[model samples]
Target: MMKKVRVERDKQGFWTHPQLPEWDESTTFADSKKWFSEKGLDCALVIMDGDLGEQWGNGEIDSCLAWEPEINIQDAYLVGIWDTEDGVVAMFAFPQIILEDSDKAAEFKTDISGWVSSDGRFYGKDERLARYAGSTHRKCDCGNIIPKNSYCNPCAEKRTKEKFLAMPVVAWDGASYIYDENTDKYFSNPEELVEHYAVDDLDSSSAMLIVCKPNYARQIEDDFWCDDLPEDISFDECGGVEQETISLLNKLNEKLKTTVLSYSPGDQRLDQSLLF
Candidate 1:
């Protein structure tokens, strides 16, 4: 098995050692530069103890502090770091390795325990290879390796809920439901809010009306409103709307009348109307 150390750029803008937080806090990249140019590093070389075996696999992994060799660090410059599940990843502008010939056996191999370098070398034990090679391992802002996307699962879910709650809605008969024709799912109404909403809230309403920018409707999935009506077809001819929905639509238009500056009766050509 190989040994790994967690490392990150500290607030002072220098990579900190995993085990020696105090030492990292005491020193900075300036010290590392001095070690390379004027003096030499006399510290114990941080080495991994295990081997990744012959099978180097797909590079995606949890974010982690990689054990970097002093030689590699000498040529490296800090670019920017992002928070990962493991910790803050100390990114470098260059010093990236380029993999050349790859062994057929190792070419398609993928592993979570180790990182693969750009040149196709497997650094199962040495995580530095993963960072240098730009592995697919995603890091959450909280500093942990997660699945492919940016936020960890927990954070992602939380964000989604927060975003949903902030969406616009309508309040009727003590229930709030916003129609999302795209997903055909109801989200909280932005226009009006209740303490909490559920599927039951939607069931309470005889009919629901979804409102979205006409042009943006298509950007959402499964929104029928996004479908362009037949050329010259008036709003009345657009079918599928319930009588209740029509009543609510009229009410909404009445409300809009107070705030809207003007309404245009554009030419029948869909393209011409859409432009404005």
Candidate 2:
């Protein structure tokens, strides 16, 4: 015949074992079976106080358990059981560190029997416990508020590519290029002069040189070359070039002249040769 077991709390608010000297304070779930073996107990059961539900703010009960310092208590629940060889065991007391409210505690008491079995095991109330356990509310690394089901709004927003050509361009043969569908043309360096100046003519080989405004003697040398051409071949003289190439070079020259005039405080001699 199965023996009947009873559990009672002591004056110090700990549950007393019926047969064992005292409840093992260092017990863990992994060692529960071993604890039974050493103490000659068959099985055990756990009971939780209803009050702990309120103490776990944000509907997070698992956090309380995970954050528990002592193994004896977890989220205000009384845990541990000892079943004897004759199928009789006593309940051990292990309470959560935080206390719950009276109203919440009352609700738990009303449904305690439904949740706890006569054999000292917990059942039938896992849904409610899981609802509280799975609650997650926190901020993401990008300073965006994250909810239970999704990431932070700001983080999602930041991940989107606003620009049409958001893909990173890997430089092959020391040249980086991106195809712009808006203009139906390829930009050699989209992040530089073309984007900043809003000019479409400049290819990848455009150069910026500082020279005097009226320096006709110091002509701007056209030394820029394409990747496939030899060192002797100039950008302008390259065969099968696009019409925009000349326009871009002219614009670059205009910018260089304007920049030089702004910095040259006095009337400077214009080297005509420098304007190559």
TM-score of each: 0.22, 0.17
**lDDT by residue (tens digit), candidate 2, 213-248:** 222223244653455666678767766667697778
Top candidate, metric TM-score: 1
lDDT tens digits, residue span 97-137, model 1? 22222221123345555555544677686655444354333
Question: Which stretches in model 2 have alpha-carbon errors above 4 Å?
Answer: 1-109, 112-129, 132-144, 154-193, 196-276
Off by over 4 Å in 1: 1-136, 148-151, 165-177, 180-276
Worst 10 residues of 2 by lDDT: 95-104
Error of 1 at 26 (Å): 47
Q: Positional deviation of 118 in candidate 2, in angstroms?
A: 28
